[model samples]
Target chain A: MLDVRFSDVRLPSGPGVGYKPQHFNDILKNAFPVQWLEIHAENYMGDGGRPLAQLRHLSERFAISVHGVGLSIGGEGRLDPEHLARLKHLVGWLNPASFSEHLAWSTHDSHFYNDLLPLPYTDATLTRVADHIDAVQDAIGRRMLLENPSSYLAFEESTWSETDFLHELTRRTGCGLLLDVNNVFVSAINLGYSPQGYIDDYPLDMVGEIHLGGHDEDTDDHGAPLLIDSHGCEIVDPVWALLDYTLEKSGPKPLLVEWDTDVPDWQTLAAECTRAQAALAKVPA
Target chain B: MTTQSDFEGALLDANKPVPAGLSDGSGRPAGRRYWVYRNNVAVSLGDALGTGFPAISKLVGPQNFKNLAAIFLRQHPPKSPLMMHYGAEFPAFLEGFEPLKHLGYLGDVARIELAMRQSYHAADATAADPTQLQRLGEAELMTCRMTLAPAVHILRSAWPAASIWAFNMVPGSPKPQAKPEDTLITRPEFDPMPHVLPHGAADFLIALAKGATFEDALKVAQSNAADFDLGATLNLALGHGAISDILS
Candidate 1:
């Protein structure tokens, strides 16, 4: 019943970019074809400020999505009610077109880590994650898209493969997936699995949105290539190829281009978004 | 059955030698993966503090900031996942922090910055109608109770924190001469702007904040600063939209 599919939602044409104050003047002046803007929910959690003011202005002009980084949904304990209240407050204020959070946990024992940490894929883990997701959706009174995370290491105790875990989560919670193609490629390379196989097994029908971001390539202690989801540079060719393959299967979804660190100008990020749009357009929807 | 609480308990332990039972694919212990989780938590919280308090970070270099942030994070893991409001206790922490006591004014500067952030994020409410003050005759205006704006913050300090913060924030601005200063932060528009208040402003605002009538606040202000100007001070507050309502 909570199937908010991409086919139901029409994403704006052309590319979208992250909203930053440094590029405010440029954003206002340039008549560029930027369609949407994504903001970190935690940044605007306060009562009011320049950040909110800018977001208000941008929101009026474009489609906005609230991408959260600190829910810690996969943690072993109960969800933080205080954090949930703040998120609910932001959702009420922004009323964004879409909302998303990572499938990782970031807190333990009442201490917040503030990063999207990986969760093991097990029946026990799956049930806990599904319950957490259900709690979040219930609290906010809306369905949310859960993104796949880029992991640097794998846990030995994971009983289920990543694909099966995601499929089970969607099945149990009735939540949609925000498939990050770059993450699949990163995990596949690091854990020595076929990225294509993972994609083939992915619950494509449950995918509501897609994220494309850059990664860092570092060698492990064994000198083998290790990909970290740095989100700092341009989307590499392999990730793009993976994206192409995903679009072919899942059809065009609301794709996002994320760049957090050492961010370039608005135009540079827009160019990356344009690439995603072009790839999505080429897919037979 | 790994209960949500059980999974959370394991994830919170930063020094876990191995992942124990939580693993995906390659069969590495959950402990090694938790290390990545630990690093991300510390780094992100540290980065959030850095971003929220840029002036503080600029005063102390990135390396020192990160080191201090790690220590601070261990002591004060954020109460909320809302990272923007994460460093509310940082100023108090800096005051008692033994290593940074030599800086003397760093804590007060942090207080000033924190107040500015609070003002910025305070709830949105309309300013008290100036006409409400008009109905009260001149005598009443001088003696009637005034309600300060929820968004206004008054910070009294022994260091010229407002001036120091201003000089550092503005590109190429001259450094402030060392002197004790009281600061008033207000969000008339969207962003909180910090202003250096004359000596009596802090005492005067404190009285007003405490629900004292204008006359009582004036008396406190005069006692705090021998040459307090009640008219000018009231005018400054009114102009800045820092006074939300006047309760007769």
Candidate 2:
């Protein structure tokens, strides 16, 4: 197979919402200010369904971004050829403006855990992750944006920081960063670090898309603050503050408001997009 | 460097010790963080199962259901990224699980729910026109093979599986009687409907799905139930748009 490169679109300066099925008819019936729409790549992998049909309709109007959650690009094993082929088929059919996946692994030993599992940032792991990303890019024939993970813990053996690791992946694979701001806040607070410092170390110039989502705050063992990337509720003040802090440096990018669990009505989701748009307006695109 | 398998095995099992050198980058053990990951994986997969089999979850209660779901995830993790297709083997798993032996009917009820999920994601097919069957000659109709919709499925059980599922799922439902029942899943619209498959109608539909001609299916159905109401069964299938084609 030829290793052809497909240039992905740099999303226009605005905000979009993670497309939810509940809001499909509403979106079709009424227009919202959300300039683009993003969907999880795994959800539409089925042969034929309302999801794909809705995506086909939405793609005609919005700048579609295919965000994948099940790629397992950071797993130790090579990327699953079957999953890669499905993704390739989906991307080929959709020709999405932006394609992205997580920097975490969700599969091992042919069984998908269905949750983003964290990884240590060591040289060997970095090499393996880079190779996996390269394979994904080569298979899809399009450059993908890798989103940083929201983790509750870190590894002592991890020699490189998360920012440095992402920087390395970007340099080696020539892929762009998704720069999930909510994940930065969740991980930094959970790991007892400065979200600002992490953002500073991040190669902001390489970020092609941004994500903002809600988080659930709780206390882990030993009474330390722990935040779960639930995406179940409204965006909190701290996460919005982190998004503001990020946009001030990274400027306006293609941002998305993701609320997957306990999804509210279209108006409620669009309200989050409005908030994102208002915030983006502050950052002079 | 630890293998991915080592990390995932620890992540899935809460009792397992974290791999060596796994820390919180603060010179402390990563035990708590590892538990957090473990909880995430178990809870997410549990939630998926709970969503897929709501009636079963309700039958077992939330706490017991959650524990069973956690155990099930460890035993049979998802193979596909599509969560819709996650628990195909769950029915057999329930049947073999010793703890749930007393509730033998639970596995059959789970089968009904699984059939519903499959029907929801099945290929879209146009319902067969009533005229196609009405115009068939007597001999031709008897020899014709009924092509069922991809979203159509029939589940037969010795327990009142369909009634139990409906009682647990819907409000204001009548208490289920301890009688054998069968279910027919048909997705005539966006949502899949699980209808009680009147007596031997399930056997008839099953035979048709297996490519048996109308005559053979009716014979088998009659063998199963001597007084099988062919008119009622025909009305049910035709009314629900379960049949998508017919071949003479």
Candidate 3:
């Protein structure tokens, strides 16, 4: 089969929310400001069920973004063929407006840890990640977007900065970027860097989408502040401020507010979208 | 070189120290910062199991279940990336784990919950023509082969597993009696509903699932229970959308 190049499909530069099953009816009834919906690629992979049915119904009414939590694109081992095939099958049918995966590894030696594990941004690691992204884009016949992970600690072996690493990935594989601003905040605070400086260095033109979410505050061993990307609460003020700063630089992109844990009712989530829309409004795209 | 190899190992095992060369931005040893990754991995996988086996979690209490999940996850880390497909071995794990040995029925309850999840996700199917079975003569009916829906699942347990599940999950359900039960899980629509099978129905269903003719299946059920009510069992199956087709 001939490998198709990255898709020309695009999502509107408006607020979107991570699709949740509990909010299905509410979204269909009144999804104001939410121009698109993003779903975790792994959730809808079943052969046939309510999940697929709901997705099918929603896709007809809204532009869908297939955001992958798995795929372990930075793993040392080769990508799991079966998982890649499942992803391909979903993309084949869903034909979502966008597709994205993380810049981290969750699977190693057959055991999926069920959490996004970080990677050192060394030259060898960059090549491996680029290769995995290339394979994914080839398999699904579409350009993939890679999202940076929230960091708790940095590796001394990493020679490249996170932004430089992401820039090189897009340069190498022709993939886009999913700039998760909340992750930027979490990583900056945890690693003693400036979030705004990180955004300035990021290759924003290649970013297909942007993400905002919440974090939990804790302290490292030295009692320095550490933020865990919990995604359980409303987007905090500082993160929203960071989003405003990021928009000032990048203008409007397909912004998403992810509340995966302790998900609020439709009204609460929609309010977040309203705030995101206001942020996009500030930018003169 | 030692990056992923040692990193993943420490994520699963709490005792393992933070991998070499990892530190906070100030170059301090990673220390408690490494626990962030460890907590994410343990808490997320544990939460998945807790959601997967709500009845098991309820029976063992939340804290005990969390500890069990920690151990179970280490022993059987998900081979698949799909979170729903994780914890396939948990029911068996409960059956053999020495600490939970006294609660022998916990495994069976877990089985029912797993079956319900599977049934909920099983392929959609058209119900078999309900009138077709009634139209056939007794001899013809016995000779015909019935196709079961992909959503149909039978679990025969020595404990009243279905009853126990109902007591825990369903409000105002009766307390479980100490008796054997055979559970038939079916998805007539979107949600899976578990029905307590009458005596010997499991034999009949198991035989039918194995491609036995109606005559053979009925004989198996009747042999198991001399007074097996074939009509009631057939009504239950037909009404619940368990049968997908009738092949003569």
| DockQ for the candidates, in order | 0.52, 0.54, 0.81
lDDT of 2 by residue, B1-248 (tens): 55677787687776778877676556666667677778778888888999899999888899998888888898898987778889888899999999999999988999999888878777788888878888999999999998899888888889988889989888887899999988899988657888988878988999999999999999999999988999999889988989998888
Give every candidate's TM-score on chain A. Answer: 0.93, 0.96, 0.97
True contacts kept of 3: 0.87
Model 1 misses residue B67 by how many Å?
2.4
lDDT per residue (tens digit) for residues A160-197 in model 3:
99999999999999999999999999999999999999
Q: After superposing candidate 3 on the true structure, give the runs of residues whose Cα lies further than 4 Å from its correct spot.
A: A1-9
Tell me the deviation in Å of residue A273 in model 1. 1.3
* Residue-by-residue lDDT tens digits, candidate 2, A40-124: 9988887664666688889888888899999899888878899999999988888888899998998887889898988889998
Report the CAPRI category for model 2: medium
Descending-DockQ candidate ranking: 3, 2, 1
Interface RMSD of 2: 1.8
Question: Which residues of candidate 2, in runs, are more than 4 Å off?
Answer: A1-10, A29-31, A219-223
